[model samples]
Target: MPELPEAETMARDLNQRVAGFTISQVLLAFEKIVASDLKNFEKTLVGHQITKVARLGKWIKFELDSGGALLAHLKMTGQFIMGDWPGHLSGQWPAHTRAAFLLTDGNSQQTLFYRDIRKFGRLRAFPQDELLSFLSQLGLGPDPLELKPEEFHQLVSIKKARLKQVLLDQSLVAGLGNIYVDESLFAAGLSPYRLATTLTADEASLLLSHIKRVLNESIAHRGSTVENYRGLEGPGSFQDQHLVYGKHGQNCPKCGQALAKARVGGRGTTYCPICQK
Candidate 1:
C-alpha cells in the first residue's frame, strides 16, 4: 500500500500537472471505481475544470469548479500515470486500469491513468459536506512528518497495544504502514512486541522522536520502494538502504546481528534482536 508520503507526493505532482485543466472525458473501465451511477459520474466530471488537487489520508481529491470533488483511493496496486498528448500511449487494461481521466487545455489533452491490479482502488464524486462526513470517520491522528515532538509524545503515551500495532493504526497516527513501523522501532531500540502502554514516559518521548526521524528520513529518500511503490513519475531507489524492514536473516546495519522476521498483525515484520530490544 502507498503510505502518506507517497500519496502526498502523487497529490503534489498531479496538482502541478492536472489542476487548472478541464476534464474533457471521464472513462471508467471498471464500474465500481466511481461513486455514483456511471452516467451520473461522467455527467458530473466531463465538463468541469479541476480547481485543485489535494490528499486526505491516502485518498486523492481533485476539486472541481463545478461543485463536487473527484476523489480516488489507490488501494494496493493502483497507480496514476500521466500520458502526454499528441503521443498518447495505447495499451489495454491488462487486469488493471480501473479508470482514466482525460483533461484538456483546449489545445492539448493529458490522460491521467489509474491502474490497480488488485481491483480495490476507488473513485468518488462527492459534495463537500458528504466528503467531510466521510473524512470524519478516519480519525486521522496527524501527519507523522509534520507532528511536533511534544505532540507525538502525548499521543503515543496513551496507547496500550503493542508499539508496532499502535503505530500502524491510522486512528493513532495517520500515515505509517508495516515498513515504517519496523524501521522506526528499530531506530528507537524498541522491540516490535513492546507494549505501548507499558513504556515509561521517557521511552514514549524517545519513541515519538524516533518515529518522526524515521518517517522524515524515508520521505527525504522518496520512501521505500519495498513492493511496487513508485514515486509519482516512476519507481524509487530508497529500497537500497532499508535497515531492517525487509532484511530478514541479514546482518543488522548497526550491530551486525542477524535481522529477524515474524508475523505481526498478519504482516511481515523485520527487526534486529540486539539493536531493537
Candidate 2:
C-alpha cells in the first residue's frame, strides 16, 4: 500500500505534470472508483482544469479550478502514469487497471494517463468542504514527516496498545506502514511489542525523531520498493538500505544478532531483537 511519502511524491509529481491541464476525457472501467453516479462523475470532471495536486495522509487530492477536488486512494497495485500520448503504456493494465484519466492539453489533443490495477484504487469527486469533512472523519494523525515531538509524545502517552499497533494505526499517526514501522522501531531501539504507554517522554522523543529521520531518509531514496512499488520504473533502490524489514533471520545491521519476525496486529513484523529491545 502507498503510504504518506509515496502518496506525497505522487501528488508532487502530478502537481507538476497535471496541474493547469484540462481533462479531455475520463475512461472508467470500474464504477465504484468514482463516488458520484457515473454520469455525474464524468460531467463534473470533463471540462475542469486541474489547479493543484496535494496529499493528505495516504490520499491524493487533485484540486480543480472550480474548487472541487478529485480524491484517489491507491490502496495497492495502483499506478498513475503520465505520458505524452494516451494509452502509451498499455501492458501494465490488462488485469490491474481499474480506471484511466486521459488528461489533455484541451487544444492540441496531447494526453496523459492515470492507470490503476487490482481495482483496489479509486478516484472520486469531492467538494472542498466535503473533502475536509471526510479527512476529519478519517481520524488521520499528522504526517509523520511533519510531526513535532510534543505532538508525538502526547499521542503516544494516551495509547495502551502495543507500540507497533499504535504506530500502524492511521488515526494515531499517518504514513507509517509495516515497512517503516519496523524501520522506525529498529532505529529507535524499541521493541515492536512494547506497551505504547510505557514509553517515557524521552523515549517517545527519540522515537519521534527517528521516525522522521527514517522516513526522510527513505524518501530521499525514493521510498523502499519491497515489492511492486515504483517511482516510475521497477523496484526502488531504498529497499537495499533496509536495516531490518524483511530481514528475518538475517544479521541485524547494528548488533549482528539474527533479526526476528513476529506477527503484530496480524502483520508480519521484522525487527532486530537484540538491538530493538
What does the lDDT come to for candidate 2?
A: 0.77
The residue pairs found clashing in candidate 1 are: none
lDDT scores in order:
0.77, 0.77
The TM-score of predicted model 1 comes to 0.89
RMSD in angstroms, all models? 2.7, 2.7
Q: Provide TM-scores for the models.
A: 0.89, 0.90
lDDT of 1 by residue, 77-127 (tens): 778888753423453543467777888988877788888878777787766
> What is residue 138's positional error in candidate 1, in angstroms?
2.8
Give the lowest summed-lDDT range of ten residues in model 1.
85-94
How does candidate 2 fare on TM-score? 0.90
67-168, model 2: which lDDT tens digit per residue?
777888878777677555434355244444566666766565545444565667767776666667866777788887787888898998799889999999
For residue 43, model 1's alpha carbon misses the true position, in angstroms, by: 3.8
Q: TM-score: which candidate is best?
A: 2
